[model samples]
Target: MKMVFRWYGTGNDTVTLKQIKQIPGVEGIVWALHDMPAGEEWPMDKILTYKEQADAYGLHLEVVESVNVHEDIKLGLPSRDAYIDNYKKTIEKLATVGVKTICYNFMPVFDWVRTELFKELEDGSTALFYEKAKVDSMDPGELVNRIANELDFTMPGWEPERLKLLAPLFEQYKQVSAEDLWRNLQYFLEQIIPTAERHGIQMAIHPDDPPWPIFGLPRIINSRESIRRLLQLVDSPCNGVTLCSGSLGANPDNDIVAMVHEFKGRIPFAHIRNVRVYDNGDFIETSHRTSDGTVDIAGIVRAYHETGFTGYARPDHGRHIWDEPCRPGYGLYDRALGIMYLWGVWDSMRAGEVAKRA
Candidate 1:
């Protein structure tokens, strides 16, 4: 596996590329133009600026975490064609700069929802937490207010400009079922997959954050079966998955190892992280270590190794640790630690394989 780190960008993030390059096995940054709104063409100058910065530190900016899909596209609105055109242009621009994989999601509004940003663990480190009961019962406005109050960094899915119309957007999606979401996603894939293939960029769709619907919002890419269906939508190597462990792991039933074995070649990127699931149906993000959480991270790494995965993989959201105050989940300290943990596991697995062959 080719390990990469997710860096928001200079000024927008506290973690520098210098720091990221210091990580033993990290070779690149999984990045995007975070300040730009979805459906807008990313300025080539701005993309080159990031490229130059990363190159200065010997890091490749090849895997983009997200080129967020506009709600119009997800809703199948008439204006979606215009937005999709912008998306295609953005894809072309990314390809120009040597980006290999573009990670995007088709979730309606919120990218990922958490009732609490800093749910303190017993160990004193905090993590992004989702209280299922609270989320189920809390008023949507109250939840929004809570998220807005806690996070200083702009949360991925909760863009203020978009959330301002949350009520109406939710109303619009009321009639949109899971099947409708699947159809809309297929529509998006049909338009973009050919363009992506032409540009030599793989379109890697991230699974829904919790791998389940939230507040009645339809989430279709939540299971291995759904992923299989998604692959069938475009039926091209360019159409792929980001294969996020924490997201898919939230649903206990998802056989992530089976997914790795089944979709081995199609996954061009991966977000490997761990989460501790509670008996009450809630969960909080944790370190990448296998023992620290419910996810069998060690097994996951071995699976990747077994598949001979040479794709770009990054440590996903990590707990806030070591008094380092930054973006709640995107903090540098824990993520760097997470990287080393993953690398340790992968190296051991590789060594074991060599020994077995010998």
Candidate 2:
């Protein structure tokens, strides 16, 4: 696997490219133009700027975390066609800069949801926490304000401009159902997959953060079966899945190993992280070590090795350890540590295979 790191960009992130370069085995950065809003075509000049920065550090900008799907596209509004055309344009532009995979999600209101950004763990380090009861009881507006205002930087999904009028967005989604979402997603794929293929890029859909509906919003890409259906939507190699472990691991029923084996060639990018699930249906992010969380991170890496995966993979969200004042889940210390742990497991497995052949 080709390990990578996520960098928000200059000035917007606390972690610098210099620091990311120090991390062993990280060859690239998973990035996007955060200041650019969804549905609009990304500026080529701005895209070139980012490319120049990554080039300075000798880091390949091959994987983009998201070119976010617009609310209009998700709501299946009349304006969706225009937005989709813009998406196609963006895909073509990204291809010119050598981006191999684009990770986007179809979740309606939020990209990822968490009740607490810094819930103290038993070990004193804090991590992103999701409380099921709290999410169910809290008003969407209140929740949005709490998350949007608490962070120093703009959170990926909870863009201030998008959540400024929550009620209207929710109302727009009221007309959309799970089936409608699937149809709209299929339409989107049919439109963009050809563009992605023509440009030598794969469109990988990130599964819903919690793999479940929240605030009555429909989340379709949560389970193994749903992902299977998604692949069949376009029946093309350009159509793919991000295969996030922490997102689908929240459900506990998702067989991530099976997914790796089944979708071997299709998964062009992966977000490997661990989360400890509670009996009460809440979860907290943990280190990548197998014992630290419920997710079989070691097994998952072995699965990739067994399948001869050479795709781009990154250590996903990590705990806010060492008093690091970084993005909620995108901290430096723990993620770097997670990368070391992943390399340990992956390298050992490869060595064992060599021994067997000998």
Clash number by candidate, in order: 0, 0
Question: Which predicted model would earn the best lDDT?
Answer: 2
1-358 in candidate 2: lDDT tens per residue?
Answer: 9999999998889999999999999999999999888889999999999999999999999999889999888888799999999999999999999999999999998999999999999999999999999999999988887887788886789888888868998988888999999999999999999999899999999999999999999999999999999999999999999999999999889999999999999999989999999898999999999899999999999999999999999999999999999989999999999999999999999899899999
**Candidate 2 wrongly placed segments (more than 4 Å):** none
Error of 1 at 103 (Å): 0.3
lDDT of 1 by residue, 130-193 (tens): 9999988988889999899886776678888898999999999998888888888999999999
Against the reference, the lDDT scores of all candidates come to: 0.90, 0.93
Query: Residue 35, candidate 2: how far off, in angstroms?
Result: 0.5
Please give the lDDT score for candidate 2: 0.93
